[model samples]
Target: MKGLLFDLLFYAILIFACIYVLPNYVIQRTIVDGSSMADTLMDGENLYVEKLSYRFDRLDRYDIIVFYPYGRDNTEYYVKRIIGMPGETIQIIGSDIYINGEVLEEHYGKEPIADPGRAAKPITLGDDEYFVMGDNRNISKDSRDKYVGNVSRENIGGKVIFRVTPLNRFGPID
Candidate 1:
């Protein structure tokens, strides 16, 4: 009876560890801390990032993503939208984004940003690089900042698949 009880306890612990810990290896949780994605995503909102989404498919424009800021802590991550794709030349003039010399049509910003800094320059992305920016251009610390430059494809952690917190706002992230 003693041996049987011990075996049962061991298996119970193993089961608990597998069910709880294993999922974390594939999925992660994050909270929006700033106004970078304002109007699109609010601050303090809880989100689920799918770490495995990009392995099989190429990331698309306007796909909100989480990636590490270059040269920053590996565990530190930032969320932004893909504005420029591989091999594309991107330029920001006033409130408009010019891609390959054509103006991009996006309706997420509330107002046209006047000062986009160096991100305003026409930059041609590399084969494995992506240009990102925050929906709240006036307040987000994004690719326009020299410190948080273009993110490498490998640095992209995952896609913001859903928002799970603030019960009223729970739904698939657009």
Candidate 2:
């Protein structure tokens, strides 16, 4: 009877670790809720976000990340691609993105940005701040918006690593 009880306790602990500890500390599942990341991550698609990478390596530009917008609690999370990194100046002029006075060459945007939002003038990032934006430039509420300004390092939850839903589009997210 004691051996059976010990086995039961061990299994219970393992189940709890799988259900709670893993999701909270190592990796988590998140669903894209809007078209902000379209042409890359579609709305309603399931994704696996790994929390381990950023803890060890520095976040790189264009790494799609999930973060809590300033002034928001954990209840809300926004997914955006990192544009301006720490200690960088970012400006959007006439549909062109300029980083530190040079044109940023990238093909992630679905179309030309129709609105520069608060990026009409050069915005400098602090040591731990990052400027982010959505692929659907015109309609996304990203760092350009007053409410969703620069995302700090602490607010970043994790980097999106893979897409799990819609079997046809299942693969690693670039």
Quick one: best TM-score, which candidate? 2
Weakest 10 consecutive residues of candidate 2 by summed lDDT: 70-79
lDDT for 107 (candidate 2): 96
Worst 10 residues of 1 by lDDT: 17-26
Candidate 1 global TM-score: 0.86
lDDT of candidate 2 over 32-137, digit per residue (tens):
9899989888999999998877978899999999999953465799889999999999999999999999999999999999999899999999999999999999
For each candidate, C-alpha RMSD in Å? 2.9, 1.4
Global Cα lDDT for candidate 1 = 0.85
Instruction: Give lDDT tens digits, candidate 1, residues 48-117.
Output: 9887758678999999998998643567889899988999988888788889999999887656886777
Error of 2 at 30 (Å): 0.8
